[model samples]
Target: MNQTTNTVHQDVEYWLKNIVVGLGLCPFASLPLKENTIRITAFLGTDTEELLGFLEQELTTIEKSDTSQIETTLVAVPNCLHDFYEYNLYFDSIDRLIKINQWEGVFQVASFHPDYQFSGTEPSDRENLTNRSPYPMFHLLREDSLEAALKHFPNPEDIPERNIQCMEKLPEKQVNELFYYLFNKR
Candidate 1:
């Protein structure tokens, strides 16, 4: 792989390990990650159509691959969807694509962006960091695995609240330092 690809993958993995799992933002993530079942693919494209095509290919790959080998997939789009608003707007088309492809229940998409912010929250709110990643990414999770994880997890409804609380307690300096690379362009 090229240097850019290596750097992207490393950044994504670091976020997954440090912020996501390390902070217990997603309690279910650690297991799959430890087992090496999470697939992180980088698509270096700024065009929306090309990114969507890559998303389609990754979805198909997940659908055909063995569940035991690949529990989830993260399509890291470092070039496109840098703007959170544009990234949010693209979800409708993403959902449509899922439904059109008859992957409604079989697969689900979760979004993470560098500037992700919850509705009604200010741009600088610390809670927004919960959904922020090293880059814009479309996280594809298998419904069955998610269901299984949820079944074992107690009070799954409290996850977002808990994550928000955790993020809120973090010092702004630490948060900014950890994610500085995300906001700064190469």
Candidate 2:
């Protein structure tokens, strides 16, 4: 891999390990992560069409790969989607593509960006940090896997609330260190 690709992949992995798994944001993530079943792919393009194409390819790859070998895929786009608004708007197209391809029930995309903010929350809200990442990326997951995990998890519906609480309880120094990307843009 080139230097840029290596850096992007490393950053995504660090965020996954430190922020996502370490903080217990997603309970199911630990197994796939520890088992080395997570795949991280970088897209150095700035165009949405090209990104969509990349997404399509990754989606197909995950669909065909064995779940035991490739449980999930993270498509990191560091060259574009710098603006949260633009990134947020692109989800419509993603949903349409999923519907058009008839993969709605089989696959799903979870978004994480450096500047992710949930509805009804201010940009500085700690709860927004729940979905924030080192860069703009699409987390492609299998519906079957998610359903199975949720079935085994106690009170699966409270995961988001628990994550928000986790973020809210983070020490300032740790937040500044782990989420430097958000402060860098300010």
Candidate 3:
């Protein structure tokens, strides 16, 4: 891989390890990540159509592969959909693709962007960091795996609330430093 791709991978790993798992944003993330069942593919395309194409390819790849080998896929798009609003708007197309392909109940799409913001939260709110990643990504997850995880995890309904509480309790300096490191702005 090229230097840029290598750097993006490293940054993403840091975010997954330090921010997501470390902060307990997604309690279910750590095991799959540690087991190497989560595939992180970097797509360097800037066009929306091209990115969608890549997403479809990833979905198909995971769909066809054995779930034991590949539990999930994270398509990292550093070049496209940098703007959170645009990224949010693009979900319609992703949903349509899933519908057209009739992959509902089989797989689900989750989103993560650098500037992700919750509906009622302010731009600077710490809760937004829960959904933020080093780069914009479309997470393709298996419904069966999700169900299995949820079944094993106690009170899965409280995860979001717990994550918000964790974010709210974090120091401002630490949050800012995490994002700065994620984007490599230092």
The clash count for each model shown is 0, 0, 0
Candidate 2 or 1, higher TM-score: 2
User: What RMSD, rounded to one decimal, does every model reach?
Assistant: 2.1, 2.1, 2.2
Candidate 3 lowest-lDDT run of ten? 177-186
Off by over 4 Å in 1: 1-3, 182-184
TM-score of 3: 0.92
Please provide, for model 3 over 29-134, each residue's C-alpha lDDT reduced to its tens digit, 9 standing for 90 to 100. Answer: 8998888888888888678998888889999999899966898988888777878889989999999999999998988999998788999989888778788887
For all candidates in order, the CA lDDT equals 0.88, 0.91, 0.84
- Which candidate ranks first by lDDT, i.e. highest? 2
For candidate 3, give the lDDT: 0.84
In model 3, which runs have C-alpha deviations exceeding 4 angstroms? 1-3, 182-186
Q: Which pairs of residues clash in candidate 1, taking residues 3 or more apart in a chain or in different chains?
A: none
Error of 1 at 142 (Å): 0.7
Reference-based TM-score of each model: 0.94, 0.95, 0.92
Q: How well is each residue in 1-186 modelled by candidate 2, as lDDT tens digits?
A: 123888899889998999899999999999999999999999988889999989999999998999998999999988898899999999999999899889989999999998899999999999999899878999999999999999999999999999988999999999999888677752
Task: Rate residue 89 of model 2 by lDDT.
Answer: 94
